[model samples]
Target: MKEYYPPPTPHEHDIEKMSNRITNARIEELEKLKERKDELKEKIKEKKDKMKEIRDAMERGDTADMILSSSAAALNKRGKETSNLTNEDLLEIQEMAIERLEEQFSKVEEELKQLKDMESS
Candidate 1:
């Protein structure tokens, strides 16, 4: 019996190289996901600040931008929150909210999940 380290073929080396490339790509994909989640978190904070501005405008009887800005801010905030939701969390939130009982809790739970996932990941 021969103790063997067979000479690597071109095909074999290509396969190993392709595997490494795939692993690198997967890592980049995960990094992009992490970056997107972080961006959404910052967006949520921006939406909160924008909402405060809109509320102040409304209180001061400045309806010119209040209607548009307030609605837009709400939409932005909702989008930011939803982007951070996992598939399961989203399904649960949708179910709870649609039920219309303690509906606000659904939103709170979703936001909490987003925050927790963001932190842990």
Candidate 2:
């Protein structure tokens, strides 16, 4: 004897359609979240690079121009003569700016962590 399978009832069909819609909506949300996570990671990397560039420029002394360009206002505000600053002094000032950048980077890192947690859930 042959076995026969019955077609789905209307309620069953509706439930399947609703399930697909929920699944698609979830996939879209994850995609958007992944994109935002990628963006935050890039920003954190750029901030790190900027910190390294400042340190490298400070070490060489030759690229004083690069360091000076960013820290000139701070030096001027302190009523100090920019031309007279020792390499060590410039490094110290740059360290302060780096500290500020690090604080901002930490906040971004926390946001990225939150995104990761959300993605996992």
Candidate 3:
């Protein structure tokens, strides 16, 4: 005598397709998140370089050219505003950029965790 097995449920294929679709979407989202993280890193590097240039100009006492290039002030008033970026202001700006980078890293980590969870499920 031959054994008999019941046919699979009609919704099984649909469920499988849905699961695959969700997985693919999560993968795409993860890729996008990684790209965004890279972009943020590049931005951080640019900001650091800018801060370094400003610091170096200040140290050399040759900030006139740097300030003039960076500001839109009238030639007469240029000396008053742009060169007034104290060390404190530079430090504050750098700190803010660092904080923003940290926040972006945290968000990327969280998204990675979620993607891993979805993959496991």
- Top lDDT prediction, candidate number: 3
Q: For each candidate, C-alpha RMSD in Å?
A: 13.4, 6.9, 3.8
In TM-score terms, candidate 3 sits at 0.71
Q: Identify the runs in model 3 with alpha carbons over 4 angstroms from their true place.
A: 1-8, 63-65, 73-84
lDDT of 1: 0.57
Better of 2 and 3 by lDDT: 3
Error of 1 at 21 (Å): 0.8
**Residues 1-121, model 2: lDDT tens digits:** 8899899999999999998997687677667656765665566566567657667876675555546665776777898766666556656665666566567657656665675586588
Candidate 1 per-residue lDDT over residues 1-121, each given as its tens digit: 9799998999999999998997687666666656655655555555555556545655676553234555556767788421343334433543444344234435545655665575576
Steric clash pairs (candidate 2): none
- Please report how far candidate 2 places residue 44 from its true position, in Å: 1.0
- Give the per-residue lDDT digits (tens) of candidate 3, residues 48-99: 8877776777787754445446463664365554456555576577779878
- Please report, as a residue range, the 10-residue window in candidate 3 with the lowest summed lDDT: 63-72
> Of models 1 and 2, which has the larger lDDT?
2
Instruction: Give every collision pair in model 1.
Output: none
